[model samples]
Target chain A: SQQGEEDPQALSIQEGENATMNCSYKTSINNLQWYRQNSGRGLVHLILIRSNEREKHSGRLRVTLDTSKKSSSLLITASRAADTASYFCARTSGTYKYIFGTGTRLKVLA
Target chain B: EPEVTQTPSHQVTQMGQEVILRCVPISNHLYFYWYRQILGQKVEFLVSFYNNEISEKSEIFDDQFSVERPDGSNFTLKIRSTKLEDSAMYFCASSEQALLGEKLFFGSGTQLSVL
Candidate 1:
């Protein structure tokens, strides 16, 4: 039941705009991972931010972790139509299992 | 980059019937896992496998479900007497090291429909 809550369940943005989503979990975690999934496709790894680290980046994706608040945020800069997908945050706490959030559904308009 | 592959992109089965979902994890990977997502729902972990044995399993993975590495390259999840609620998109993933530290490579996923 460590399921996290992702704000702005759905988002819409222009191609040149930036999209930001927030995730808040219920328990402490060692590392938090971000994943993206296109409709009907498997989830793809975007980035991973450890509890000790505050922020991590990969290409246009930026992930920030706030362990004290049990929350995290993902920012996509200059979004593209292809970047449209559901983004999820997953974390594990002293276990081999990962609990995924409901995810933020993003749509970028050209 | 090596990829995890799952067989039968989609599966349709009758309730009370048995269905086996097959997956071939990255050859060099040592850890395997199975996860499923019901339509419009969050992804749920079913089980994790390491060293040819189950490392961990969630409460959702009840006695009706079982996993096996029948051969060197294959990992399978068998659901006995499938129920309607079993319908979901099942994904298979693998990682070279412990998932807590390593990113996983996931297969395209197998859509299971229990009719």
Candidate 2:
């Protein structure tokens, strides 16, 4: 079974707008990491938030985690057409393996 | 920056034939992993290797699937007999550590097409 499920399976926004995607997991995790996959490409590590941390930022990317709710959200500010890709949240529990979410396909129209 | 690399950007094999996918992880990384993503499906974990042994594997990794770190720098996944359902994009990843919080670096992936 999948441990994490992403909401708004698909999203489309005009360039310069903000895009937010949410993910809910089924169990406690040591950390949660977000990744982006461009069409026909490999997964690209974006950012990671530890269980003890509530939020993290990198350039235009912001991620928030609420362990109490077992959920997390990824925000991309001032989106661009180059930001178009499928986003996935992976939850890491007490192991080296990461359980990935269903993913959210985001499209940034120019 | 160092990056994981996979060979044969695309592979085409017939059902019942054996196939071997190769990967070269970051030079100094100690943990290696394999993942597969079927078209229109989520990325699925296949197996994790550490200390020259398999640390963990998912249910999708069956007897027909095998992994080997043949030398110090190369990791390979071998499927004894390919099946049509096995066609997917196979990604190889590596991490500097085996801890839960370590980030992974993934290769571009090898698209497997089984006929």
Candidate 3:
């Protein structure tokens, strides 16, 4: 079974607008990480938030984690067409394995 | 910056044939992992290797699947018999164990097409 599942399988926004995607997981995790994938490519690590941390940011990417709710959200501010890609949330279980969500496809229109 | 690298960016094999996918992890990393993603599906963990042995593996890694670090730099995943359902993008990742929070760096991936 999948441990995490992302909401709104897909999202589209104009450049400069913000894009928000949510993910919900089923099990307790030590940490959560978000990744981006261009079409037909490998994943690129974006941000990671430990269970103890409520929020984290890197450049235009911001991630928030609410362990109580078993959910997390990733926000990309001032989106650009180059930012168009598929986003995935990966939850690290105690077993040292990461289970990834089905992912949300984001398209930033210029 | 160091990066994980995989060979034969794409591979094609016939059903029942053997296939080997290779990966070269970052020189300083101590942990190696393999993941696969079927088209339109989530990335799935197949196996993790440490100290020349498998640390963990998922059910998807059946008897037919095997992993080996033949030398210091090359990690290989071998499938005894290919199946059409096995076609997917295989990614290799590595991380430093000494680092408190291990952040995996992944390779570009090898697209395997089983026909």
Candidate 4:
């Protein structure tokens, strides 16, 4: 199974604090993407970082990829209650398929 | 701001029955996909379609499963026979291109319950 695994299956933080999640996969990948799912809702694409890139940022979200280690991390800075959701990391190898991780449940307390 | 749309937010069916889940992907998107997540489990890929044909499919997408574009705007997944283990949330997704790093827009999903 090439599915990625996310550490710290759950995390809790205050509104003003930063939250981070890590993902590790078993095989090489062409790119990695992070997505957020508000309970019972569709996944919203957050950001994507290619294997050649080290880091990318979008508004309050930051993503880092390390192809050498087959691992990636997502950081949400200045988290808010609205940021409370399940975050998943998906890796795409040479195919169109995206293998998703187990996901990290994040809770942002007011 | 186009988005994928799925019909029948929830469906309940008995084992051995056939059910077809429908989805309408973004208007301009060329790539379409179906994925499912069993309760308390990670999301798993089912199939990917492009050029009106299946480009890739996961092991879970066995003979019991089939996908069809059917028309210009609708994509459908038909389960030949539903089983107790078939209960899951099915999500439809689409992207303008099938490139390695392109982002996919997903639909809200349909929760299927097999009894």
DockQ, all candidates in order: 0.73, 0.81, 0.62, 0.84
The per-prediction i-RMS, to one decimal, reads: 1.4, 0.9, 1.8, 0.9
Better of 1 and 3 by TM-score: 1
**Model 4 ranges off by over 4 Å:** none
Expressed as tens digits, the lDDT of each residue in A1-55 for candidate 4 is 7999997799999999999999999999988999999888888899999899999
Q: Model 2 over residues B2-111: C-alpha lDDT tens digits?
A: 88999999999999999999999999999999999999579999999999999999999999999999999999999999999999999999999767878889999999
What TM-score number comes out for model 4? 0.98
Ranking by DockQ: 4, 2, 1, 3
Looking at candidate 1, what is the lDDT of residue B90?
A: 97
RMSD of each predicted structure: 1.0, 0.8, 1.2, 0.8
The DockQ-based CAPRI class assigned to model 4 is high
Model 1 chain A poorest ten-residue lDDT run: A90-99
- Report fnat, model 2: 0.71
| True-vs-predicted CA distance for residue A63, candidate 1, Å | 1.0
The ten-residue window of minimal lDDT in model 3 chain B covers B95-104
User: Could you give candidate 3's per-residue lDDT for residues A21-105 as a string of tens digits?
Assistant: 9999988888899999998887888989999999999999999999999999999999999999999999886755778898999
Which tens-of-lDDT digit does each residue in B1-115 have in candidate 1? 7789998999999999999999999998999999999995789899999999999999999999999999999999999999999999999999888757577778999999999
Which one is best on DockQ?
A: 4
What clash pairs does model 3 have?
A: none
State residue A74's C-alpha deviation in candidate 4, in Å: 0.3
